[model samples]
Target: MAHALIRRTLHAAAAAVVAATGLVAAGATTATPARAAVTCGVLFDDFSYASASDPALAQRGWHIRTSAGGPGVPGATWSAGNVSFPTVDGQTVARLQATTNGTGAGTTHAEMSLPDRRFFEGTYFARIKFADTPVSGNDGDLVNQTFYTISPLRYAMDPIYSELDFSEYLPNGGWGATGPTNFQTTWYTYQPDPWVQDRQYSSQSRSIAGWRDVMATVSGGEVRYYIDGQLVGTHGGKFYPRQNMSIDFNQWFIDLTGHSGGTSVWHENVDYVFHAKKQVLTPAQATARVNAFRAAGTRHTDNVTADNSCTPAETPPPAGGTTRIASNWNNKCIDVPNWNFADRQRVHVWDCTDGTNQKWQFVDGTVRTENNKCLDVADAATHDGAAVQIYTCNGTAAQQFVLSAAGDLVNPQAGKCVDIAEWNPDNGAVLHLWTCVGGANQKWRRA
Candidate 1:
């Protein structure tokens, strides 16, 4: 499990917003490019009857816990969302449709239970496309809900779990009091405790329509939310442990009650692509992977498929500099020359001349300018064309970093980590964040 930094009330609101968006903001620095070594692990693996029997789930360290409301009782025909084993494309797909209520709409929920007890921090992306709607109430009358869930129970709501709802919709402009398109990314301490909600966590108060890709990451003591390729919000610092959480994809009715009775919502197809790389990633690297996976459709798959090959990246910290920034981040902090806030503001580690840009802080896990802003990947590009820039602080995970025991710096957002440019053993070369492997590029030495 990752260590939780000390909690502070002063930055709670701001940090919560960051936790909601998933992507971290830009800061003063050179945007680290995505290295080939950093790749995905187990991109799409659905454990349904098609791939394996329900019993086999336990053998693979997964359990079919219960549903949201409860187990299917007598007269209740619960559908075990259909699953298809992986093909050459390497994808485990699961499909489920909700039952309609009197209003012709229904809600469905599915979950996956994990076996071992471990604390892991990573990102998840889900692709979704909804079916037709017959505008019962009025025009633009859409009713559907989709969510990515995490449960602590072996089945059902035996023990309540946490949830990251991408889009929760209903007829007549959303389910009763529920908001439209806007989602609630919450954390539940226990079954009794009410879920802590962050409503403004999203970058906008709108719904993601058509085929949309949403990403989320949890690291250290922080949890961040992202949409498409942009950073959104962040939450949870020093609150919960990084436990071994299972992955779940669910679509349910907007109004379980008879608000919009008997309306069935069919999600034609869903693609939840995951890459479990053991290394940390820079925002640029993570965005690149997301875009690539988005373009690749649901057929792409790879975990540990990339070359573990890496190069040295860190330089020894100056004498007496005991402070560790991030294990993969070079301790060198250069002064930001007196430059205007142009479109591109590449940050560099120079002699700690104590300039405005040189000052840095690890706020809620994300690396931030002492001025309280985040270092950003200008224009969200994967190619070398992208430049590193600084922008207003947003608590997306992309800005978060960690210092490993080996003095290596890691970015939980990208899954790929930081690395030294080369083994020149000199200070002039630039330090960049790249795909992670156990290489000198991922190691650092503080003076």
Candidate 2:
């Protein structure tokens, strides 16, 4: 759950578009060309846990919330006790229960999340059962049942903040809205106090009272959301996630306003979840994959690995601190051939010199020369041996590089190291991409 205030303002333009065009009709699907199979990572969990304390759950990187938190009724307790595994409809399911007695302190929220913020640009799928009425008490609490992914907010309006709300089902409605509305929101960033937010959402108003397939596909800068194989919304631009995020499912009370007196208990159930890293799968294709896994008796599987070894810098280097990027193999500085600053000029290593082309400044994930040309991967290629050159900075992933503490300059998108081609040590040795093997030719440092 992000914040209560964050969902208050829906983008007017998005709302207008939804009103005019309407959501893609149920069972509507787009045909896409078949792609050749590529080696990709994946994660799937049937969530057949014995209890909230199941060691297998923790081993699989799941954390049940026991800490107190916001994004719910203030002072509400978030407890591990609220998360349980039970047999429902002959299937083991993860269940989250939220209860309230008309007071903040008397409310308890439930949440389960993965600790690793490594999911990005993938197809996420979950089968969830959302309840519109409490099992034991009166209904009408402003409860939120959600399946979302989020990265930490380093600061107010952090440009790298990423979050995608696949579904936020409001059975009774909060933030001054009517009941039984489901929202799919894509977030850019937000501020807590004084309440500011940048987000886009599409909503459908109706009773979604049972098990439903909720999926979101992230690729090519856009996030397409589908419910039961029906396209519900598509959002992109700044709202597209810029960093990795943790997958989460939570149920919390928006406020205690709907509570009458007695304790009201609401439940959200999750049958399973799946993620295909860096792959764009349609809802039908994703469902087929899930079925195949189950048919093969696969309980759980996880092969998703970190995209790169380098941790990105939180802030750019100090101003006026440009330095020569010297290759450890020959102590030669990365240089622009013959002082040419033209786009697509191949960058090479030259003897340590006083040339401005050899002086590079680290700025917002890009290495820039004195002539304002960026060190970029030619053709935006991610394959091995892709050429390295100087190009106009366009803020694409090809222009992003992170110099690691271990001295490897890595293109995170390509998961490759900047290497002196073929371990060449002579002046004018060209640069290219290669698997990070920690070789001398792949190591660089500021000189």
Candidate 3:
């Protein structure tokens, strides 16, 4: 961990090769280091299962190292026994161990992957550990701790392939490079025979020999890498993944340059991983999302999404800023009665009064009142005439309301527009979600 920056040359073809082989890449283009609060949207897993073959794992699309494949060198083989789940820090973590039983013939790699293959774009998070030396013995071996996405080839030399190595940590140096270097490689394909598929990647040399929070955000055609909550590098352009990928984590040796065939075990610990598809949260926002999940006592959840694509908002909020939201038809101001913060509190149209309750902030694809509460569709209802009430904002599409060009507040997730009950303009007339009609009750004017 002595070098400041690994010189990652932008040889399109060599980027993928460098990453796969654990070569310390020197960047041709300067990668701006990000220093900010870490945050993201996530798919979370705390590895609380009893074993790799636990029923909960199959239900959640996880499988251990049963498949024989080498992402490393030819001698760096894979085996199932090298993978285990043990308590680390205060929680059970997915532990991938690569051990060489005194000979290269018995070396084994440990990997776990999501077999669902539905993940495409979004932020990715994993709290992990990178060991520079063996837990009990040895210090000169080369090991890789990786978190990546891959669209496995359906056939030999399949053209429909993609991969994004969000992180490839070479803790003790591999190939011809120095130790403690990290990389983020965006690959479209690595086929070099009939066709040449290239990649875009960024890398740096630093000391990360302990538990580190690694993050990646894939949104708006850009791949941003983060350490802890600060940005490290960004990758984009045509090499952005062309298809969905299965999330993967593995620990293996990069033994082509030097081999340490010692009878010792090398471990990589992952506390949890979080993925939020179709959502690109800022570092602070991403942290909050994961914190909320932990707060809710979630050790495992597949209820959010493992879908193919993320549907980002098409239109941004109007640039005018916070204003008085008055129904164009009745001229009454949309209000969060008495500045209510309670869930399901009825939001109504009252006299403008210019009070905080009557004022609204249109920001980041959602509408917020005086505080963190947003106008939420009750129960995230999709059926017609669902009530629109005040609720604490949790960054769900249910709370995301888009003001349309035709003048209606629409919740795209529900495919419903915000409307007033029965066209009423009374002081307590509540708001609801109905089919968008571009009608008077659905139209609002910012004052």
Candidate 4:
């Protein structure tokens, strides 16, 4: 996000001041309003590459940072050499090794950042290992093991300028603080000048002792933070990022005037990093999805792209909900005729099977089929016995029906309930509307 500015030599005193006051605590604020948002499927990476030279990582928008000059006068030297891909637990993970020889702020910091910045308001995930205590002899150093997101630092006033820090670990304390305090922060910037800083942010505190799964979902006007499948905090306000951001990870010292510097190759491992635009899945669902991809031997994919046209988030995908509407009168399930895909097909009553074909979603003002079509009052007729048919969805009242308290799917326009022809219960019976009859045949069940 702000790699160019963050890795370059800047005002150390100002940067230290920003890190001190800016990262002191966590809180919430009022969220700002915006237009509707869009969504796509996913972009995933398992970090299966063996080195930075691997084209896979580059093809997937990955760039290892090895520039200088940042929070410290010369932020830990970004070194591609310190980046590695080592086998861990039978899988290859991106290994970032940070080393310093107690010199000035001249430590070697391993970091990588993605190039995509259109990832606003969606689910994100990362499996990481914050080795606070070095594997070898390094320990007690105030190192920061981080995973974050940032927008182009064009200018603080740039509407797209935003940042979200999922994990910023200070193992040996930072700026008058103690060891082992992890942070999750959301940011909005305000610049009084170029060198000096005045940015606003909300944050949450956490303690990470080992490998942990981190995730966040930015939707419904809020940003939700989670660690290891547990809710951590929610941030919403005028600060909600105005645009997409690049994902990043780095491990470096806090640069407390060299007091926090130390030697010994310390490392942070990343098993994977994933993103699903506008799709909010449970931690279990996310893990399962990732596991499935791994089991299928998938290393990376960019198939999921930005959907510029905003589409309102609807109910879960057709196959995800636990809803099957059954016809009580027929004691059977209401399914599409012959499992056909043709529009205007009369819905039929079939022997109860509790299958996906019988599934229905009553969203907004319409009862929709699993196929993204709508149950319609044929030809927009408002007669008592108007024909009922399946049709391509068009957000129209003609396709809307309410689940009445009387247990009837009543088309309010015609004031009639969906019923089987002649009160028949045989399989393949066509459906139509009739005067509300509070009887078994007139009733439906969401079983």
Which candidate leads in lDDT?
A: 2
Clashing pairs in 4: 7-69, 8-69, 8-70, 9-69, 26-203, 30-237, 31-237, 66-78, 329-440, 329-441
Query: Candidate 2, which ten residues in sequence have the lowest lDDT sum?
Result: 19-28
Off by over 4 Å in 2: 1-40, 308-447
Q: Model 1, residue 288: what's the lDDT?
A: 50
Q: Write the per-residue lDDT of candidate 3 for residues 1-447, one digit (tens) a residue.
A: 222222111111121221111111111232441111111113568888888768888776676755444455455567777777899988899999887665557777887777455567777888898787788656666678888777664433355567777788887665346757787777755543343446676777776878888888887788898988888888888777766667788887766344444576889999888777666767676666566556535566443333342233322234334688888888888888777678889788888887878767654455777565778888988766898888877656577665654576767555556788898868889888876655688888777
Tens digit per residue, CA lDDT, model 2, 323-402: 89998878899999998999999999999999887999875456888766789999989877999999976556677676
Q: Order of candidates by lDDT, top first?
A: 2, 3, 4, 1
lDDT value for model 1: 0.40
lDDT by residue for model 4 (6-116), tens: 321122112211111100111113243111111233567888896888887776677787656554425457788988898988879999888776665546777787745
Could you give candidate 1's per-residue lDDT for residues 262-352 as a string of tens digits? Answer: 3443443454545343334444445454453344232332222222222112221232223323223444543334533333455444454
Best candidate, TM-score: 3
lDDT of 3: 0.67
The Cα local distance difference test for each model comes to 0.40, 0.77, 0.67, 0.65
Supply candidate 3's per-residue lDDT for 206: 74
Clashes of each: 78, 0, 19, 10
TM-score, predicted candidate 4 vs. hidden true structure:
0.61
lDDT score, candidate 1, position 243: 32
TM per model? 0.44, 0.63, 0.66, 0.61
Question: What is the TM-score (0 to 1) of candidate 1?
Answer: 0.44
